[model samples]
Target: MGLWLPNLEYLNLGSNQLVGSFPMSISNASRLRVLNMSHNYISGSIPDTLGNLRNLEMLNLEANNLTSSGMGFLSSLTNYPALELLSFGDNELISGELPGSLGNLSSTLQIFFAARCNIRGSIPDSVGELINLVSLDLSANNLSGDIPRSLEQLRYLEYFNVSFNRLDGKILDGWSFGNWKNIANLDFSGNNFSGAMPDRICDLNSGLRYLGLNDNQLEGALPLSLINCTDLVILNVAKNRLSDTFPHWLGALPKLRVLVLSSNRFHGSIQDSIATSFFTKLQMLDLSSNAFTGLLPTNFFHNLKALSEVVEYEYDNYRYSVNVTIRGLELPFTITVAIPVFTCIDLSNNGFHGEIPEAVGELSMLLALNLSHNSLTGPIPTSFGDLAALESLDLSFNKLSGSIPSQLTSLTFLEVLRFQNNNLVGHIPRGKQFETFENKSYAGNLDLCGFPLSKECSNGEGSETEKHDQVNGKGMAFIWKVVLMGYGSGLVFGISMAYVVFTTGRPWWLVRMIERDLKEKIRSWIPKKKRN
Candidate 1:
């Protein structure tokens, strides 16, 4: 095994239990372009002689217990002209300033990853000189101070992450990040940066497909400029202090597939305009923990062809959620957006009201549907039985009423059925699918019965028809009680009037005249109405 090929251009000894410091003999391969020695128990300082490999392009020494001497060895790499990709992540090196000479590698450098290296102090402004850099990740470190304004010069950067750091400063404004239109991913989450997101963060990058800016102090409205990035597939701006009405600009993006805007201060009704036809390719949409409210458009799922495919099949636990504002109230309205073509949909913790759409049954390929913690009402749609592929269904903490549809028993593949805290009634079906669920699945229901609960049918037997009749009888009784109460009150009032007429000798005209005289006196004493 020691008889190695002298012409080896790449040597990968990563993730093995290789002990001891990097073998200085590795420098013998003068033509080696790639050297990966990551995720091992490798100790001791990197040999400074590594800089002798003038043709080396990539050098990775991550995930080891290297000391300050090891870091000093990396400083020697400042002389290597062809060194393009360098990684020194997840090491125990003490805090130190990056050498300014790192800027000298501007000619051919493409990637520089130094995450979790415990390096502190301000990021060197010289880093902006790496004009040829395409990917730069320095996350999970203690680097602080304003991100260098000079970073805007990196026109070729495609993937950049500076998250989990103490960087503070307004994100550079008007910088042409869009210049890197070919960039597909960018993450700056978990930082202390404060200020409105740069208005042009995505201005030039129409081809950008993913952007994450969560867990920051970003304020102001969502940048309307993002609409220009029509190719975005994932956009996460959650857990920030963003304040504005719902971002209407998002509806313009044709290729957007995932949108997460939760935990912000956005307030407004989920506009019907945005719900009508946009988001044709959206698969995961989370607008939770906001002040959006409104009746979700009935046809909200129509334009999403992927959703429609799920609804057309027989599946189970199909889930979909819509956050909205209704009548000045914040609410989350959720449904089994799970159709036969999708797996899950979550619309919990919003201000949605109204009946669950029966069209949800068309999601035959759905696996899980969560519509919990909302103001939704009406009966569980019997069409839900069409979802044969469903596994988990959560519809708890809503105002839903009526009996659990026996058709739900058709979901033979269901594993978790959650409908707690709803006003559901009637005997729970004790069939193949129903028998598998426990009391926890149907707990908060006052009128729910059957195999899971001790409450039997009205006839003290598990009779399906008897249970249905019992539910019907309760409904009838409720209606009659209301009607009878109104009728009885009317009868009482009529009897009292008759008694008054019989007992009083005064005519009706005399009573009316007295009342009119009093009203005229009162009106005369009052001031005249003012003009608007």
Candidate 2:
């Protein structure tokens, strides 16, 4: 707790288990330029005394239990003109409202993060004063009210996030982004936003790589102008009120990797993209719980080269993450493009009808596939056996017919297999992963008979209609005969007993038999301890 080093220019004690309140004595290090105490157990108010370091360039106190009544300490930071970054995220600051003077900090500040700090109230309009900010995060807070229009002043901003807030109102007009030429990432997800999305978001077409607007009240069609974001990698607009046809034009964005449009009002068929390169780099595609109809786009999957090939990706702060429906559950997963392994395609809970394309099997690196709750018909493509890395496959609640291809038994890594409620007939595939499936996996398919099902397959391997009917008839007849015999025997015994009771009128023979039986039962019921 002794800060005698007057010339200390750099201090980084991040990612440690240090505890206790802010060290006020640190102010003695007047020459300290970088002070980082992040990822520690620090608590209590951040003392304004830290601002005494006139040469301070960076101050990071993120991921601590720090609290403050009014965050007045931010005003003291203005004393240092060289400050470039300030991070105080993931702390219970209890700062009911950010001070308007927050915009008065050094103009050189390029990064500011106060996320999950129990911050409430509307964003102060003066925030626009920090025109040089490159990164700003205020996510997962109690922030509400409209975003101040003054934010448009941050022309040099590159990354911005205000997700998981209570902010409401229509999205800002396109002109708001006209000056944001350098904006690369912008996220407004998990908000109460409503109204049509502005097409002018493409104003930063050259540098915009990520745009997330999911879980909003947005309506109308996707802005076709988004096709201009040539550098866009991830575009998520799921769980909205949007109503539009599939924007085939989006496939033109060469770097687009993840596209999610689930739980929306999107309808109509996903037309074949004339561009052979459509979605070539795409790895995750989720279009479930929509009203899309017509055949599953064959050419679309044929062009999904990224799912079939081994392509490395650079790991950086831009790494994407999402909640995927795997085996009927929504699981969160971060996409590490560097791995070049896992891939998934979920089209469940849609109105799509038609045979699955054989081309899908070519995605040998695919890890999960979901086509459940659709009107799909025809046999499962045997090509599916080629998906060597597949772990979860769901094709249930469809009209699929014919035998399940035995080729599926080769999937050694398969853990979740669902094929229930289909027209599939014949013996279930045996060995390997198929044997691990329970009876529910083949339920509602009356014609399917095998080890898991109660209806055993005939030894002759009868799959034809005539043979199946014969087996069913014989089994039914045997059951009927046994039932009739039991009924007759019960009736005959009842009649004989009634006759004996009426004729004998409690005869001596009956009395003698009852007494002997009662004595034998009493002897057996005697306690073992007493007998001993």
Candidate 3:
């Protein structure tokens, strides 16, 4: 394809349905600087001949079916002194470890991505030589071993992700990460990294926005130095062995939006919000599966102003995603504060008690709320009807009592409701989204009776009573039988028996006895006038 355009300087054939092997003739374009063939069906190894383009600055071949036994092509590209960006992510056929010579690439290289390339072995310490790297992603591979302390040399690194790998060892224990001054997004999630998190890592430049160290073996309290990162937006250290009380000081960060500390050994009660602005901008808060106790933070709920508003941010593209449990299944959800959707609050599976705060209903834009598996009591707040954007609501396994607020029927977006195993009573709310819920939503609430449940509410009349079969057979005979049976027995049981008899066909002998003994039976059961 390069035969006709030997002087081609730019080629972006991405996002097309292009098929077949990588075009070998493209090497003829010696002046080509930017080459992108991403999101295509291209196959075969990236030919080393393309390295002939000495003027090449960017190369992206992501999301292709390309195969490569090793990343030898990367070595060939080192000839291009001007090479700044290199990406070959999402090519599962690319196997083997990153060659140590990868550090021999041009110092001008600022972004390198080899994610999901089936790569193995530890990251080479030589990677520290890439001083100009602003972003490096080697996630979703078979990578093992600890992060090299040499990575601290990337003073300009802004984004670094090595998640979903088999990496282990303390995250550079005791080594100060002070050189990562420009680092903004750091993700080491889904790994086996253990040991207490070193507090010095928080010494990095305060521009740090996202810090994800989830699904690891990190222990000890969250670093207090994190409060220095005023720009921090998303901090997820969930599924770790972190043993600390609630880090309420995090609320001091104005930009913090998503804070997930679930599945840790964190204990103690979450205190009330100390300031009105505390956690005001936070949108997603997940503290599930911990040893936390005390009342549902009422004042804290009042401070979550962002969850109630339709906030639009300047950084709309920087969406932070988190896993949320819905109906016992964990699902990932991309949460963007710029968008009005997907705001969530999960405090389930804790030792929290006391009534859920009425202020919680102030979060009218909340999409998912899970407070299940706690010792929470008191009736659900009627104010919950104001949660107009709510989709999933789970208050199960609590000591919550009182009838469900009928006001909940106003929630048009309500789809998943779980009030099971509570002390709720009275008829379950009907109509609107409530009608769509099954009996399971109200299960274990023995006193709750209505539609989806087999148990019917007492004192039901009109349509409720009409639901039962009408009494048949001779109407007069039925009345006489009821009177003879003693009026004090109540008409409900008498009607039920009469209806059964009529439906099954009455025995003439029993019918005759009822008809003849009607008077005699009444007289026998009645006492004569009180003796004087």
lDDT against the true structure, per candidate, is: 0.64, 0.73, 0.75
lDDT score of residue 332 within candidate 2 = 44
| Cα displacement (Å) at residue 290, model 1 | 1.2
- Tens-digit per-residue lDDT, 1-532, candidate 3: 4365777988878768999999999988888888878779999998989878888877888889999888778778765788877888889999877767654473777778788899999998878878888778898899999888888889888778898999999887777777887777778899999988767766754577778899999999998988888888888898999999999999999888888999999999998548888998887888999999998777889888888766655643343344444433344443332344246898999999999888898887687899999999987887787787776799999999877776677776676789999998777767777777888889999888889889878776323322321221111111101001111110011111231132334312122212333444435433342211
Worst 10-residue lDDT window, candidate 1: 482-491
TM-score of each: 0.74, 0.82, 0.83
Which regions of candidate 1 are displaced past 4 Å?
1-8, 15-20, 39-47, 63-70, 90-95, 274-276, 310-343, 364-367, 431-436, 454-532
Q: In terms of TM-score, which candidate is stronger, 1 or 2?
A: 2
User: Which candidate, 1 or 3, would have the higher TM-score against the true structure?
Assistant: 3
Candidate 2 lDDT by residue in tens digits, 51-132: 7888887787877888877777777786578777778877876487776765346387777777878888988887777887
Which parts of model 3 are misplaced by more than 4 Å?
Answer: 1-4, 311-329, 336-341, 460-532
Query: Which of 1 and 3 is ahead in lDDT?
Result: 3
* Each candidate's clash count: 48, 0, 0
Judged by TM-score, which candidate is best?
3
Candidate 2 or 3, higher TM-score?
Answer: 3
Candidate 2 TM-score, C-alpha based: 0.82
